[model samples]
Target: MEITSKLLNSANAIIEAKIDAKSIENKLNDIAKITAKKVKIDGFRPGNVPVKIVLDRYKDDLLKDAKQELFKKAIDDGLKDIDKKTDEILGEPIFSKFDEKDGNIDAQIEISFRPAVDVSGYEEVIPEYSTPRVTKKEIEEKINELLKMIAPLEKIEKDVLESGDFAKFDFEGFVDGEAFEGGKAENYILEIGSKQFIPGFEDGMIGLKVGEEKDIKVKFPADYQAPNLADKDAVFKVKLHEIQAKNIAEKLDEETLKKLVPNEEDITIEKFEERIKTQIKEDKFQKLLNEDLKPKFVDAIVEKINFDLPNVIVEQEIDLQFRNAWDSFSKEDMEKFRADKDALTNKREEYRSDAQKSVKLTFIIDELAKVRKIEVSDNEILQTVYFEAYRYGIDPKKHLEDYKNQGILPAVKMALIEEKLFNDIFKKDKKEEKGE
Candidate 1:
């Protein structure tokens, strides 16, 4: 066999493989010999059939099978030689036409070659990073949020249900004067201002006395998931039983301060405030590390590299972007989106450019990892996987295996490297800012 390669472009290559006719003949003879042992005819038992009979009965099939096997082996050998000469493959090879008419087998294979990029000067190109400092307002806001999470609800002796007050009520809903399923409740506590019920239900509860009964009319949303109720009009007979309001904790009080810091027996308001401040600082630092350092680092590396990416990588990135976009869109809106084929096609092409840039950036990052010898230890990966699984309320071992099978292991490694790079950059910037 002989192979010749021609570069179609930086991203694609064409290889021509020529297999010897004598070799093809030898394979066909070997296949025929193997088939003779299994051949059975009308007059002869299996393995005792004549060679001439076997040749007549199975010659065409054996030849076809032999040719395919020989071609596959030749292609494998050719690809191995190509990879040995050129470092790595970027994508799967696409085979073109095969000629079998004139006793010689000639085939063409098209492959996408990995991009060769010269990546350097990333450190110089990247902007100096600066750590964000937590502010008093931020800490105060965090404390307020924490207080809201632990806020207590107290019963109110109000005469009427009002906005921002919870109303305990008995209600029954009907469509066309007939009751509907899942439309009746007894002593249900619902916030008067919250749109947890149908649109008009909450509004109708307002201005109603504790013992008053009223008929509330509402229409289900057009995109409601229940097929029977979507866009349907209904009347609800509502009776208000009681009213309640939220009693938010005071920041300066002793009882509230103890709740804020549960473990500290003698925790003062000042100590609670200090803990909130510390947590705010840590959260702000992480946010800044993600928002500021990551983009800057990626931009810096992208600027230092120049290469054309394989189409497959770019397509994969585009798929990721599309999935993310689809996730954010409402179900009704997504149905409309799917109907707009031309618009979606245009949007996909527009996203493809962004995907291409992402693929190029990924290539640069991988090169950086190689140059820096960045590696994540098995223990580190396991710990990180377990931590993420715990956050999602999943079993760690199952999540780890799922992640590995889904090819997320490389993504995890890449994330670790990016995190390390960001830390290094931020530390250097901090030192410079402090005049160290």
Candidate 2:
């Protein structure tokens, strides 16, 4: 057996190995010997099976297991020869070349690795962004939005329906004087100006009187999802049964206060508004970081520090981004992308900058995490899981196992870590700016 290491680049290395086929065969024979003791054959005893028979029946399986063992051993030997450890390897060893000759086999495998990064003044170079301003108007709008969410319905005595009013009505559609399927509903509650109905249907209901029956004509969009309704003109006979309106309170009631905050007491308007303001700041801070600051920060850090990136990691990033966006494409569009190599390459190239940014950021954050001794806690993970489950209307207790199985738990943990690190950096930068 012979093995040699070659540095293809700073971030990539290749390990070439030449192994005699006789050695592999010997290993296969040993594996066969072990299998013979556990074998079951019609003509053989419980603990006895012919080696030749075992080899004949399981040569491929034995060779596969032998190859795995040999591959691991080869990696260990290569690392020892290079004075490196497994931790230096970024991703798995990619099989670059494999061929078998008469009595020996030659193979080359590639490894992507972390390159040294000089981030001495990353704090000074990375961009800082201002938190989004929370205006009084926005606060009022948000409060109104929340009020709408929990507003009570009240019957109105008004005879005429107007914009922003709710109407309960029965509607049936007809095309060419013939009723169409899925075009009728009884006692449907609809808000005017909501546009929940087809174009001109809800607008046509404006100024309609309760107990009045009328026909609304509408033309379905040419690009409508339903083939049968596309580009078709239809009429709906609407009979308004009731006029309803939403009523919101002037002040937060006791029950409403508890509903607003399930786990809080002594909740006042001032306290609630302050809480909402804090929440708004947190939400805007995250959005601001993700959309504006994060990219600029990454670019600045990258510009300040130069390092080689592994092609394999970049390629993986391109593939991952493409797959993440795969669902947005039509089958025809996806096929075109696959069929046209130039187009696909161009598309991949567009993401090259972003991929490099992400890969480099991962390395920088990893080292910082180690140096700072930053760690994610189990309690934090559980809190994130329960919060996410609650936000998505999943019962945390019931879907705890599901989250674990779906790999959501680890992802949440990583996300929390990233959020925590960036937020700390933001605060530190702000303090330095203030000469603190």
Candidate 3:
């Protein structure tokens, strides 16, 4: 095979190879010999099929397999001939010109390589965010939230049902003078003004006294989950049995503190409050990192750094993002993409910018990691995998296997490494600010 290569850009190239007819003939015959052992023709014994018959009978099948093999071999030999490693290749090679052309097995393959980028200005592209502060008010709010979670309902005998009150009742709903399925309940507790029930069902309970019998008219929303009830007006014959209000916990008493921190030994009210504050701060920090800080940092880096991106990598990122989003689309939504061709075309163009940004960021992160001599440790990867498994209630070993099978093990490590890189930068910046 005669091989030659041309650099299209910093991160992409075209490798052209030409094969002699004799080589093709030789490989074809060798494949035919192997095929002979697997064939059992009506007139021939097993492993005794004639070579000519095998070639004639399965020429197309044999040639397809031979072509793939030749392409792979050509790629390996051609890469070595040009001094490139398989590890440096980003994605699969595209056979741009593969056919019997110009009296040779002429093929032109397009390949994407990991882009070489100088991320010197990456440290300057820091995300602007303050570590979320837990205030006394926030702690009080959290305490109130806990109060809501554990609050008991107390029966009311005198005061009329008011908004934010829970009312216990028995009701039979009627649509067009007929009771419907799932429209009747006995001793159902409905929250007034909470909108837990259908439209007007909760609001209609307001201003009612205990033992009061009233008819609440409500309409099910047009886009209701149950198709049968959609946009239907119904009358509920409600007989209020009792009015109940939340008895919120305002003081962290001995028993309440124990209940709040059941697993903590020798815990006090101050300790409980401190623990709650710490938990809230941790939750907010993680949320801020994921939702705001990370994206801002990535965006800032992408804006400041410039590099030639592999077109194939960008295209693959676009396709992957499109597929992941498409998986969530409803049948009707998917039909819209098919019916409105312009919508899909416009959508692809819209995703193009994000795809390019994602690709560029990937290359930038890799370059940063290399320049900084940063490495992701096996223990870190194991911790991340185990944390994910614990979150999703899956076996960590099986989840790790699944990640490997899906070709995302490297991606997982990259994600952790990227996070660690940013965190280290933050730490350095903080220390510098403190003149440490």
Candidate 4:
């Protein structure tokens, strides 16, 4: 066998392998002999079939099988040679061109090679780490939100309904003076300024007195998801029946505080407030850390690295991103997405670039992990598995098995390693800061 490789692009290679006809013929002859011993022929016992008759009956089939086997062997041998020369095999080989004219066989195959990246100075590219500070005002705001969650609503007798006030009304909506489906309701309670109904609806209810009937006209927005309602005008004949006011409770009392903490006998409003503040502060700190770290890390890594990615890997990443996007879109949005094929295609290409960046980043992270000798122990992995299961409300054993089968265990390990890397880098920087 003889093999030659041509560089098609930075990420693609074309390999052409030529196998000896004599070797192929010998394999075909061996197959024919094996078949003659087992295969039955009319008027002749199994092993007694004539060689000429066996050749006549199974020559084509044997040759085809032999060619496939030889092609695989040639490709494997060629790839082995390439790997020996370059020390890596990145993606699946794409086979093309099989010639069998006049008993002479020649085949051509194409394989994609992973690009080697020279990654360094990722720390310089990523931003410096700074801990986020939680303020007193933010803590107060969170407490207020908690109070509103426990607030109650109260009924009010009023002469006129106003914005921010809940109004109970009986209404029938008409499109062009004709009633439409889902256009009428009795005793419907709506907040006048909530904008929950069609445009101009709540505004028309303002200043409406109980028992007063009025026709409210409104137009649907042009980009409304409902096809029948888009840009359509409708009139709702509303009769205001009642008005209600939102009632907010005062600060947590002994009873309310007890209800919030049934298990803890020593619970107090001040303790609860401090707990809320602490939780809020942790959440804000994590969010700020991610926002500051991710872009800087990617930019730094990309700046230091220069290499082409295998097309197979990029395409695979593109498919994963497309599936993720499709899963996140609503069914209605998906229909609109299918209708706009060009837009979706553009989105796929954009995701391809993101996939490339992700691949490049993975390479850099892996390199860093190797240099730092980062490792995750079995005990640590078990702890992580249990924590993740509890967080997601799943059984630990079942979730761990599922993660293993789905091949996500490595990803979890990588995440753990990356966290360690970040901590180490941050500590080193802190030491330098202290020294300065």
What's the TM-score of each model vs. the native?
0.69, 0.79, 0.77, 0.62
Any runs in candidate 2 off by more than 4 Å, and if so which?
8-11, 114-118, 128-151, 171-186, 196-201, 215-237, 248-265, 310-312, 325-351, 369-374, 382-409, 428-436
All candidates' lDDT scores?
Answer: 0.77, 0.81, 0.82, 0.76
Per-residue lDDT of model 2, residues 171-233, tens digit only: 999988999889999999999998887789999899899999999999998988889889999
Among the numbered candidates, top TM-score falls to: 2
Clash totals, every prediction: 0, 0, 0, 1
- Cα lDDT tens digits for candidate 3, 259-344: 76689789887887888887887778778777887788877888888878987788788988898788777888788899999988
Where is model 3 poorest over a 10-residue stretch in terms of lDDT?
427-436
C-alpha RMSD of candidate 2: 4.5
lDDT of 1 by residue, 295-387 (tens): 776776676677777765666689889888878778886777689988677767868878887889777877776777776788888899999
lDDT of 4: 0.76
**lDDT, candidate 1, at 344:** 78
> What C-alpha lDDT, on a 0 to 100 scale, does residue 49 get in candidate 2?
91
Ranking by lDDT: 3, 2, 1, 4
Model 2: weakest 10-residue lDDT segment is 427-436
